[model samples]
Target: MRGALNNLLHGVRLICAVIALLAFGMSVAAAQVRFDKQPLTIETGAGARHQLTVELAVDPQQREQGLMYRKQMPTDHGMLFDFDEARPVSMWMRNTLIPLDMLFLDDKGVVTHLHEGAVPLSEAIISSGGPVRYVLELNGGAIKTLGIKPGDRVVSRQIGSAG
Candidate 1:
């Protein structure tokens, strides 16, 4: 009888462990935040238009994180890092996997500088010579393929409100 009771208790513990794991998995899945895809339009010289889907980072913390540790980013998807005040901006690709093209934008959303083909896992500082309030990161070759260049006017809607 004692041996039988011990076996039953062990089986109960195993069942509880499995249930806990399942609950944790569900919580993680629920916690993931998803944003609606939005079109970002940029007007090039000679009145040409280009569009891409971009994710917005409006807050300071989100802007700081800036897609760190992301293994893959889709061709049409990118992150737009925003700042409250325009200032000289710089970035690095530490722990990043995919190469990216960084579009540094002035307060009016005009692309002031383009840092194309940023290497992965590199700590080299990529900077916009002037103050910029926004930075958009897309696949490395996207800018060249779309004929994007400096002085292009870019537009994007922030995902969520400051509230």
Candidate 2:
């Protein structure tokens, strides 16, 4: 009986150790996600505009994992996707828990189109009707709240920096 109890205790300790290691690994990976702030300005035909701080998603891998699994984000925070070249771009929200508004931009940072209040975790393809090089994702309903329209523009120094 004593030997059996000792074995059980050892197994429990091993499980605990494994769980701790996995948790530590997750934290390490999350740490790699840098939220570098860049200004993204939006213009409305009503003679007004809004600015937001965005995190640049400049690489293929980062763009693939854009905002996935994140439970929440600040209202003023967003992600900017830099395609590095002019082309028609499509986006989906698979594995994303929060709704987002997607803005497609041309080479000059002019907003060419938008998808507002995109359903969370949806696999629907959101596309830029014309060739574009940048895409911006913000919280759902932000486009209406900020009065952002199709002709509105977005600006950031991170433009064309896909690294």
Top candidate on lDDT is 2
Error of 1 at 155 (Å): 1.2
Tens-place lDDT digits, model 1, residues 9-122: 999999999999997875555346343456788788868887778877776655656676677888878888778668998899975778999989887788889998999999
lDDT tens digits, residue span 7-95, model 2: 99999999999999997886567657665567877767777868788988877777877887789999988999888898999899987
Point out where model 2 deviates above 4 Å: 1-31, 160-163
Output the lDDT of residue 125, model 1: 94
Evaluate residue 32 in candidate 1 and report its C-alpha lDDT on the 0 to 100 scale. 60
RMSD of each: 7.2, 4.1
Q: What does candidate 1 score on TM?
A: 0.72
